[model samples]
Target: MIELKALNKLHISSFYKWLNDSESIRYSLSAFQKTNSPDEVDVWFQSVLEDTKGLNLGIFLRDSEQLIGFTGICKISRLNKSGEYFIFIGDKSQWNKGIGCEVTRLVLKIAFCEKGLNRLMLTVSEPNIGGLKAYQKAGFTPEGKLRQACFRDGAYHDKIIMSILKNEYLKSVKA
Candidate 1:
């Protein structure tokens, strides 16, 4: 299982190491691969900690004390009770090992059980086929695709909007 722990100054070293990895930056946002010094990362981490709309979680493996990845819900709008999810695995070797699914489940648990959030949502670039499938396994469904939502690698890619309502997620979890 995975949980969202407080990311403090100490965890910054390993976390920043992950950010610098080429593989880790590949599927993330446009600024994912941008340069950042240790000081810059310190500031960024502190800023995310202060973000009011969403919780930035440091994903950890319970048994091994491994910092396998990071995941968070961002861009929240209270009127809609909606937020976007972002996740990245630090150890590329851990890919497709079911940890990502567990992390996603934990986030939904927080949203439905604690936050009383009506809807949890995310947008995955069409190129991120694996992410789209993993999200569905974790209770999200494709609402639609935004045409040419991202321009990367010299080509335009669609952004797929996916969401799970509190009722649907709760019912699925119970079943």
Candidate 2:
């Protein structure tokens, strides 16, 4: 099982490492193409901690209490009642284990139930098949695509936009 708690300084080092990891950051739209410096991670971490519009959580294993990755909603707009959702599983060993899907569900619950958001959305690169599959499994439907929006791996990739509204989420959880 997976649970999300407020991200703290204790998880900063692992978060830094994950941000710098080539394999992990490859799919992130906001991540720089190169490894980030420790100072950069510190600055970003502080911003995340201070940002009231965002909810940055550390993803942990329920039993072992191990920090594996980070997940949250950012660019939150209260007037719009919308936010962009994101997740990164830093523990590469834990990939392909359905952890992403479980975390997605947990985040959705927080967004709609706790935070009272109307819509949650995400963007995935075309090459990120695994991540795309996980989001789809979490009940996000593809809304649109940005052609050649992301440049990665020596080529440009399209960004697939997906979203789930509050009503859709309520219906899903009820079924």
Candidate 3:
């Protein structure tokens, strides 16, 4: 099983490694293009640890307590009651095992229930097939696309936008 916990010191290095991992970073909107320093990671952890509007949680295995990935919402707008969703499964070997789906569900519950946000959205790079599939399965529908929105590799790539509203998510969970 997976659990979402507060981002703590023990998980910092793993998250930093994930930031530097080329394959993982490729799909991220803010790709860690270069190797980030430990100090930089510490700064990031501190910021997320203090953010009131955002939910930055570490994804861990329940039994072994191993930190596998992280997910959260940032750019939170209390006035608008909306936020953007972001997640990464740091363990490459654990990919395609349905963990991402579970993580998505758990995050959605928090966003719509605990945070009381009206809308949650995410941007997926066009080439990120697995991440796109997981988000769709968790109830997000493609809202639109930004053509050549991001410059990655040697060329630009499209970013697909997906979202779910509070009413839509709540109704789906009731069924």
Candidate 4:
């Protein structure tokens, strides 16, 4: 029902809006900072376009081709064959529909099968129950927790660190 593709300039406005959405930022590190303006979003987009070590993809509805969200494997280390995973469903209406889990699997295939990465990791704020579930469902195992790693809503919260290795991914797909 959804697919991933390269993001373009046409998605700038939506990206800007999502970054500024209070609800969307509730579990995101973006709550600690500010996106400020469309120009800032454009600058960030340009950097994503030029980053050879990263892959930023737009999440779209396969039926209508609407851009609903975005996901990425960032800071890819060639030496270690690892990267940080991140995703945002900008369209609030699409939440809690198992889309996050679907997108996570798609990115895992790209990270392990295509990119030849050995490990993909992510940190989900404790309050982000949806993200935690999605990642776990997609085969990421919790490695540890970072105590008070993120501050939001006037309180510090723990972050759950999760990861899936190349071997784990291969076994999961085969099963």
Candidate 5:
């Protein structure tokens, strides 16, 4: 139902709107700051394009080819063979469709099989129930929690640190 592609300038407008949408960023770090304008998004996009250690892709609907979200493995460490994974489905209409779990599996394949990475990690706010479930479905296990690490909706929430090792990912795919 969706495909991942390298984000281009054409996706800037949609990205700008998603970044500023309150509900879209409710459980993310984006909630803590403001995305003032499209220019700022353009700058951020440029940085993503330039980052050699990161891989950011736009999630597009297969039928309509609409840019609904983004996913990436960032802060990739060559020596350690690990990276931080993140995703956001900005289009609220697409929520709870199992897309998050599908995307997580795709990213896991890229990190462990394609990139030869040893591990992949991510953080999700405790209140993001869907995200927590999706990550678990993709074989990530909680490593720990950062108490009150995320503040949203007038309160603080724990941030769960989750990870999957390459060997674990390989075993998962075999089954």
Candidate 6:
């Protein structure tokens, strides 16, 4: 679980740890080479705080404010009423515990209800079968796969485009 708060400068160390984890980095699509200097993190935090188009939520453990993962909407277009998205559970040991699903569901509530966005869209690599199922359970319908969009681990993987409209999400929630 996570609480959306103002991005802080001190959180960089934890973010860096998350980014360094291979499992987490696999989902993040960000390149990190061993370390991110404090100055760089400071700048990054400043930008995240100044982010007006979308939101980044620092995921935490409810019992402890331990930063476990991150979930957010990007490419937020108020005029277009849409956004692209990503989620990362940094600690690989936590992957199969339903925490990722819980975090995603919470964010989706913010997207469709709080933000009043008409649609939410996300992409998952073809090999990420578990992620695909989780998104499906969250009411995202597969739009199709982009062939060879991701090149990682000496292989190419398709990216699956999935989206859930406000009406669709509402219906799923009700059902």
Q: For candidate 5, lDDT tens digit of each residue in 98-150?
A: 88888888888888888999999999999989889889989999999999987
- Over 4 Å off in model 1, which ranges? none
Question: What CA RMSD would you report for each candidate?
Answer: 1.8, 1.3, 1.6, 1.5, 1.4, 2.3
Model 2: lDDT equals: 0.87
| Decreasing lDDT order of the candidates | 2, 4, 5, 3, 1, 6
By TM-score, the candidates rank as 5, 2, 4, 3, 1, 6
Residue 40, model 4, lDDT: 75
- Between candidates 4 and 6, the TM-score winner: 4
How many pairs collide in each candidate, listed in order? Answer: 0, 0, 0, 0, 0, 0
Q: Which pairs clash in the backbone of model 4? A: none
Candidate 6 overall lDDT versus native: 0.77
**What is candidate 2's lDDT per residue for 59-122, written digit by digit as tens?**
9999998999888999999999999999989888888888998999999999999999999999
**Candidate 6 lDDT over residue span 45-83, tens digit each:** 678778887878777777778777667898888887888
lDDT of 2 at 138: 83
Instruction: Give the true-structure RMSD of model 1.
Output: 1.8
- 109-166 per-residue lDDT for model 3 (tens digits): 9999999899999999898898888888889999999999988888899999999999
In candidate 3, which residue pairs clash? none
As a TM-score, model 5 comes out at: 0.95
Q: lDDT score, residue 49, model 5?
A: 74
Please, what is the whole-model Cα lDDT of each candidate in the order they appear? 0.80, 0.87, 0.85, 0.87, 0.86, 0.77
* Candidate 4, residue 169: how far the Cα is off, in Å: 1.0
Which segments of candidate 6 are over 4 A away from where they belong? 1-4, 31-43
User: Which ten-residue region of model 1 has the weakest summed lDDT?
Assistant: 29-38
